[model samples]
Target chain A: MKYTEEHEWLRIEGDSVVVGITEHAAEQLGDVVFVELPEIEAVVAKGDEVCVIESVKAASDILAPVDGEITEVNEALTDNPGLVNEDPQGDAWFFKMKLDDLSVLDDLMTEDEYKDFLG
Target chain B: MSDTLRRTPLYDLHTELGGKIVPFAGYAMPVQYPMGVMGEHTHTRSHAGLFDVSHMGQVILRGPDAALALERLVPVDVAGLAEGRQRYAMFTNDKGGILDDLMVANRGDHLFLVVNAACKAADIAHMRAHLPELEVREITDRALLALQGPGAEAALNALLPGVADMRFMDVATFDWQGHALWVSRSGYTGEDGYEISVPDAQATAFARALLAQPDVAPIGLGARDSLRLEAGLCLYGHDITEMTSPVMAGLQWAIQKARRAGGAREGGFPGAERILQELADGPLAIRVGLRPEGRAPMREGTVLWDAPEGGRNLGGVTSGGFGPSIGAPIAMGYIPTTSAQPGTRLWGEVRGKRLPVTVCDLPFRPSTYKR
Candidate 1:
């Protein structure tokens, strides 16, 4: 239900957060086969290039939604990258980042809003 | 896009798994997923990567003397090809230009051919016109999936034993959950893997079975391109085209001695005269490997320039990309044969900026396949 203008979503999990690509971003990317995630402990800033997602025609960078430190990465991505395509908002979580400013989420679009924005 | 589209047998599975399907080679195929190509390419190189390649044409050529009949159309020393040995070869026109490249295997009396999906119909027509006596059957009803990577052999062997015994350029008929298929130890990715060509009706079941394996997952065409690029393989339209000859492309090695010494490369096939002369005196332009200076990609059509003053535009990049293996950007293009040497410095014009480039050896990554 949560969303970002960059087409990523953060589903809360206790103190940590699970992030995945938005369905819109996944649809735009076509079929994704490989996902490159940032290493753990890698510090990232808002809008910084944190990771990469590759589709057939183009390889896109997944920008950081907020300045924070990468606490964990989805190791499964190396073996099963198509998970992002399966459930962009669910199983395709790329990494977990502690928010530098939780307020950044407020600037992001909601799931409903993002769906309409595409129109 | 219109819903009036042709779907591969794995269509439903692709949608369920969230594959981003796109039109390619006349079929709606998964180009990428959310994870992307770079990760997928690396994963497949390190592990196993699945690919639905049903779009490629799987054909069977049958006739009283199919080998003799096919020899009139292409050059690959077809007569000497063993029954189960696969060959990477080309179909040439009367003048020696390549019509298309294909994998031809002698399956006993008949020939089993795997061709590019985009050129299937034209290839069939060309073959028919040249060898009318032979019967060509399009097994388009079948679907193919390429399982490539370092761990590919073990993953496939789990389901079908004895499959791992086949070496590169080898093929064998196997039974998959009651469906028979022609599985080849071959792939576009320079990995030890298998290309399973199975009946369409059983493609989904086979795909499901493979997915059940812990190390297996579906890969899209996106990774396929990058991996092949890393392996320095050529794409049909971009690298090898009808306008380009095999000799110029540095594919003269694929031409058998019997064909070249038998006057086949002399002029029998279309453009053979120019091609043979190019082989003798060397081509005016040669296809050479290129590595760019920076992270920015220099894709096809990026013009090449001779370095220093008074330099001329030598050629254009036919294919370029950031290779995960090389950890840098790479490309290939046609340059003056005189300047086509390893370590030769050149320039690649990207958005009008001249980036320093250098000629490297073919293939940015060493192939790990058991060739």
Candidate 2:
């Protein structure tokens, strides 16, 4: 698993990368009440905001970590947004994107690097 | 946190309870504790929640003409207010705009006023400049704390007896550990609770005593806000502002009949011409409760429209968030009188997408005030 400066975690699966916010972001956002995911099969760039997450306090956006096409989105979040707060890194993965170059993941930060960045 | 921000009497206790300190109205106050906003909100609805509202200004108006002098500023009937009773009031500008909303209680010899934190200085100055004959003394030695929710009476009564017997909107003086507490059976959250004015030195101890109760927990500003919104209450800086009139904000109920047209003591207050006219006729725009169809909350400043594509720009949301008690998104905003009816359909633009919203009767939840 890799991390982005925007507090998103990326997990590589075959040619696709699963993306979700880190626990730090979830904790900062308080309880997740609503999630608006990007359309499936939508193309996106690294800096594009692909999702919107609404917590009890405020609304925040989830930016795409790398240039990719959104192949899948977690629909469960629409019915149960609290899942993002409960299992942000696992079952709450927002979307799966198919990237042109999977090697782009190497440029991201490791777990240790993410912790250092947080510090 | 900035060094210039003031700290409340409960600052140490808040830090001890793992409260997330944030800047609010020039004070370093807790937005939420370790329980988080959602838990605190629900807890306050079911149990009792203690809020350190010491940031708000507390003032004592004394002199033989205090009530009459205060009536010159607000639209409410101050002279008609009975002793030991509290009434909601607002300081209106000359143009009928709201300067600040406040709570005024007739405490027999003197009147106690509670104004919003952000509007404290202006409210004080306004009162002093207008009511120069009266004493508008600001009480800095007292800290205001609100104990709200269904279990508030039991928790507060356990420590300070006689609070449970006070009816809603009733004010009384109670003794607690040698401190004279100005207790009022009222609160911002539409709950059966009390707002206690304790001495600054004893504020923390009194709060701790209440927290010791099995039904009491420490709540923060975040929950206080959501709870008030759910109760369909107007936030001073949000739902009502200097640009908004009391009638437009649906606060005409606070204006007493004695202060209206044809009454014995009518039209002596500021903005009386405009306010009385609005009361007799109607406001062009009115504040109404809005509920978004989806789980996504329509926050403040979200624009409203008549159509999803492009129709007419109606108005904007003022106070909005996910109402924990209602289990959905609820909001309050100003819209044209034509579109202000409950059940009227409207659209709020969020992230450039128009989402369906319905104008509903406010308080998404019913109030449980001990009336």
Candidate 3:
């Protein structure tokens, strides 16, 4: 139930947070054809651009959720670009980042708040 | 930015993806996504791609003698067009200028017309105004998706079945989950694929299913442009228009011989006199393909020169880009017929730099047609 103003979503998973583009963003992009992931161990800060997500008509940069270092990249979408368009929330996540500021989550919108913001 | 964009069922989808939407022929369409244009262009050529072309007009022409009447408007041999088959044709002004480019398909009893989204209204209005005796119906609610790439046929065949049987330029009807769809083996991208017309209700689902295929991916307008550019197909407003005759645009093959008969030929269409005259003699200016010496993309309005070193300015570029399939920059333009020969060297002024260019065949890419 976490969100970045950029429309990325995160779910707390004990030591890490699973992140991906929100349903709203996915629906807006029409069909996401490809997701470019950042390299593992890549360092980043809050509001920093790290990755990219491409759709049928356009490509979107994946803004960092919080200051962190990328630990894992989603290799699944390399060959199958449509993975992001099919499941932006569940399977289309570009990568995982190790938080530099663990509580940067405080600034992000919750699922309900983001939904309301969209409304 | 203008509120004039006619939305498709996928409008909301484009907005959420951070699509940089722009007005195109009255539709709010994405020009390029955040990845910029080059990546989007490359992705579509090597892999499968999807496109939302719902803004294009789908029309139905019906009347007692619709086929015979339509033949008068276009040069393609309409009588030979079998049911379920489609052919590209143009509406020429009496003076021979191209009014519009459209696809005329025989959907059993009547003719189904698919016109460019931007020119549809004028095209329809022109039809109703001139052929008052004929019936023209606009099917505005349907949405169109173009699935193009080397893998399109296989991906679609796995989902829709029977659709693979359609060869290049052929068509077939399939029932996807309950909605009837018209799928054709024609596309703007120089790939083996199809352009599908589906009811709005089923368009998204159809797109989803196609995307689910292992090879299918969603492509945007950006890639679509590069693909078409490499293929050397003309875009209506940029390549041909009512002010430009078919002969000048290098579309003489579209005029059927029977339609070319005296009194019935070119001038009878639009600017038929100019078109017929251009055919009898050669056009003063004609569309030609251009190959630049460098990789920079030459764009519309770039001045053309007849000599490599400041030869007299002969014409200008109309559409140009880094063609994905061609693996290089390509351009199209109207140049003097005297300089239209392949290998004829020309110069394109890009950003004040006169880039050396060569006149090539109309299609920079070898057109792979099932015919």
Candidate 4:
């Protein structure tokens, strides 16, 4: 799993990768009341806004970490957005995408590097 | 945190309780605790939430001519406010604009006031400049705390007896642990609550005692704002600005009948002519509650248009966010009087997306104030 400066995490699995917001992002957003997900098979570029997470305070945009086509979105988030706050890294993963460029993963940060970057 | 940002009496307490500190009105205040904004907001509605509102300014008005001096600045019927009661009031400018909204409590011997934190300094200066002959003392040595929700009265009553008996809008001074504490049965969350003014020295211990209760949890500004928005309450600078009039803000109820047309004390305060004229007819624009069409919450400063694509701009959103209690996106903003009617369809342009919205009756949720 790798993390982006925008607070999103990506886990590479073969030609596909799973994505979700970092726990830090979840904490900063307070409570996750609603999550607007991208449609399946939607092409998105690196750093492009793909979804939105609305909390009680404000609405925040979630951006794609790398260029790819969204293969599957977490449908469970539509009904129970609280999963993002409860287990952001696991059950609350936002979407899975088919990787268009594997080299983009090298640009991301590891778990330890993400912690140091936050510090 | 900015070094220049002032800290409240409960600053250390907020930190100890894991509150996320943010700069608000020149003060480092908690925006939410570890429970998060949504949790705190819901806790306040169902149980009780304790808020550290010490950043707000507390003032005391005294002397023989105090009431008359205050009456000259605000349009509310100050003289008519009975002893041991609080009334919502606003300071208006010569142009009929709201200088600031405030709470006026007649404590019998002297009048007590609580003003918004951001406008406190300017409010004190305005009062001192206008009423130089009367006594205006800013009570800086005290901290103000609000305990709000359905369980507020029960939690507070455990600390101080007889608070449950005090009806809504009532104010009185009572002894707590041998210290004199001034309390008012009022709050901004539209819940049955109490605002207690305590000496700064005892603020920490007092707050700790309240938090020890099963029904009480330390809430922060984030939930405080959401709760007020759910209850359709206006924020000071955002919803009700100096450019907005009380009448246009839908605050006509704050203006007493005695201060209106043909009454004994008609047209004495600032902007009297314009306010009275509006009261007779109606303001060109009025603020109303709004419900957006979809999941995307329309934020403040979003332009409201007559049509979905393009048309005449109606007004703008002053306060907009998700209402946890309502379980949907809700908002409040100014619109033309013609469009102010409930069920009027409108469109809000946000980030280039035109979203449908509807004018609705305030309080997206019913007020459970203990009146």
Candidate 5:
């Protein structure tokens, strides 16, 4: 598992990485009311804003962690946005992306480094 | 938080209740508590919620000419208001724009005014400069608290015996344990509620006693805003601005018949020409309630268009948010009178994409005021 400074967490799957917001980010956002997901098979570069998360208070954007094509998105969030607040890192994973080189994840922060960064 | 920011008398109590303090209107006020904005909003709809509104300015206008002098500034019947009743009013600019919205209560020999926190300093200056015959004294030694919801009367009446007898928009002075509490049966949430003005020394204890009841919870500004939005209320700096006239903002009802074109006290306020003309011929642009089609919330500053693809650009949204009680996204914005029909279709441009939105009536939810 790897983390980005923007409070996104990425976990390596078979040939793709699952991206979702961290628990810390979800807590800061309070209650999640709506989520606008990126379309499947959409090509995106690193740092590209692909998703939008709306809370009761404000709206936030989710950026593509690394260069990849979106493979699948969590359709469950469309019916129930509260999943992002309930299980932000687990069942609430936003989308899965196929990266050309999985080794790029090595440059991102680890669990220990992310915890220290939060401090 | 900056050191220059002011603190309300309930600041210590809010911190003690785990409130998340944030800067609002030059004050370090609580935006939400541990209950969160959604929970607090829903709770306020179902039960009583207490809000520390001490940041708002409270002023008293004395002398025999106070009511008549105040009538010159606002387009309302201040002189005709009864002794124990309060009326909603606004300070209009020379260009027919709204300076600020306020509540004026006829407190026997004096008129009690409650203005917005951000506009209080300028409002006091404006009142002093215009109504020189009246003594304008700002009450800085008291704190204002709003207890709003369907359960508000029961909760407040448990502590203060006679609050249940006061009807909506009624104002009275009650004695609670030797404290002269100035209370009004009015609130911004469109619910049966009371706005209690207590001395600073007794505010914390009074709030604590109210919170002791099961139906009362300490709400914050986040819920206060969402509640007012659902009630079709205009926010000070947003919906009603220095550029939006009363008729344009759909606040013509606040202007009584006595202040109209052919009435007894007509044409004395600032910008009376434009306001009276708009009242007769109708405003060019008017404010309307809007509901988005999907779950995505169309927030403030989202531009409106006449068509989805290519059309004329209308005005932007003034106040927009996800209404917890209504269980959907709601908004209010200005648009052309031709397109202000209740069921008219419009498009709100959110993040470069035009989404479907329907023009609805003023309030998204029905007001449950105890009339």
Candidate 6:
């Protein structure tokens, strides 16, 4: 698992990575009411705002952790956005992207490193 | 290293209940609790939510000429306000701008006034200056709590009976555990609820007692703002500021008929001429409700234009957020008088994207107040 400073997390699976926000980010954003995702086949770079997660408090950007092309977007979140708050890590995965360069994954923080960074 | 923020009487209770503290209006207030903003907001709409509103200013106006003196400052019919009734009013400046909006409750012997925390100092000073002979005493020895929702009356009446008998906007004094408790059957959420003024010494215990009830939970300021916004109520600094007028803010209904032209007490208040003129002829800009086309919610300062691509800049969104009860994103803002009617089409520039929006009526949701 890889995490970005912006509180987004990614998991590698074959040639693509599954993306979603961390539990901490989900908790910080009170209630998840709406989620705006990037279109499939859209190319995104690291630190680019590829999606938006809106809560009752405010709307926050979900930045891409690595350069990739969007492969799949979570269609279920359109009807039930609260899934992101309920299971931020598992079923609530925001999107999947095919990686352009595999070396960028090593630049992201590990799980333990992200914990310390949060503290 | 730095001065600490002021704490209310429920500060310890808030921390113990896992409330997230934030600085607001010079006081450290709880923005949300462990239940989160969404939970608190839904609970307030369904059951009941107890709010620690101690930071708001509570004042007592006493004197034989208090009502007459107050009418000179506010544009409301203070002289006609029946005893034990509450009236929504605002302090207008010389140029017809709103200084602060407030609630005035006539308690027979004295007037109980509640003003916003940020504008409390200025409101009190303005009142004192205008009514020099009248006694304007700021009551700091009390803590205010609002028990609001559909279950509010049942939960409150379990301890103090007959509170449910009071009509909307009714104010009365009751004895709670041998202490004088002032309660008004009114709230900002457009729900039937009560705003209780309790002694500071018993505030913590009283709050805890309310939480022990079946339907009461400790809601924080975050949910409070969302709830009020969904109810289409105005926030002082955001919606109606010193630069906005009561007429432009769409609060002219608050001015009683007697306070307007050709009434018993006609045009005796500040900015009366301008307010009456605007009443006869519409104002330059008016506050209206804006409903965005899609799911994305617009925030304050989002530039509104007449056309989708680019047109004349009409106005900007003042307050916008997701309304939990309505299950959609809603907003309120000021637009030109020409496009203020409901169903008028407009476009909002949000995050560099031009989103289509429709001009709708105020109050995204219907009020459930028991009138």
lDDT of 3 by residue, A70-102 (tens): 888888976665677678888777788777556
Tens-place lDDT digits, model 4, residues A34-119: 78899899999987889889888778899989999999999899888889999999999999999877988999999999999999
What is the lDDT for B241 in model 1? Answer: 86
Q: What is the lDDT of candidate 6?
A: 0.91
Full candidate order by DockQ, most accurate first? 2, 5, 6, 4, 1, 3
RMSD for all candidates, in order, please. Answer: 7.7, 0.8, 9.9, 1.5, 0.9, 1.6
TM-score of each candidate? 0.79, 0.99, 0.73, 0.97, 0.99, 0.97
lDDT of 3 by residue, B1-371 (tens): 76755778977767766667878777788776655455665666666777889988999898877877887777666767788888889988766677789998888878888999878888899889877888899997789998887777788888888887788778778888888898889888777778999998887777778878887656567777777877888898888987778878888887767556463333345555676677789899989899886655577788998766745989889898666556566889998888899998888886566878988996877655555
Candidate 1 structure, TM-score to reference: 0.79
Model 2 CA deviation exceeding 4 Å by range: none
lDDT of 1 at B313: 90
Clashing pairs in 4: none
Specify the CAPRI tier of model 5. high
DockQ of each: 0.12, 0.95, 0.05, 0.71, 0.95, 0.80
Error of 6 at A20 (Å): 1.1
Residue-level lDDT of model 4, residues B1-371, one tens digit each, is 88999999999999999998999999999999888888899999999999999999999999886877899999999999999999999999999999899999999889999999999999999999999987899999999999999999989999999999999999988888889899999998989999999999999999999999899999999989989998888899999988889999989999998899987788799999999999989999999999998767888998999898868899999999888888888899999898898998999997788899999999888888788
Q: After TM-score superposition, what is the CA distance of residue B304 in candidate 4 from its true location, in Å?
A: 1.4
Error of 2 at B171 (Å): 0.6
Candidate 5 per-residue C-alpha lDDT over B145-241 given as tens digits, one digit per residue, 9 for 90 to 100: 9999989999999989999999899999999999999999999998889999999999999999999999999999989999999999999899999
Higher-scoring candidate on TM-score, 3 or 4: 4
True contacts kept of each: 0.15, 1.00, 0.05, 0.75, 1.00, 0.85
Lowest summed lDDT window (length 10), candidate 4 chain A:
A27-36
Q: Lowest-scoring 10 consecutive residues by lDDT in candidate 2 chain B?
A: B262-271
* Candidate 1: RMSD to truth: 7.7
Tens digits of lDDT, candidate 2, A47-89: 9989999999999999999999999999999999999999999
Return the lDDT, model 3, position B21. 82
Who is ahead in TM-score, 2 or 3? 2
Top model by lDDT, which number?
5
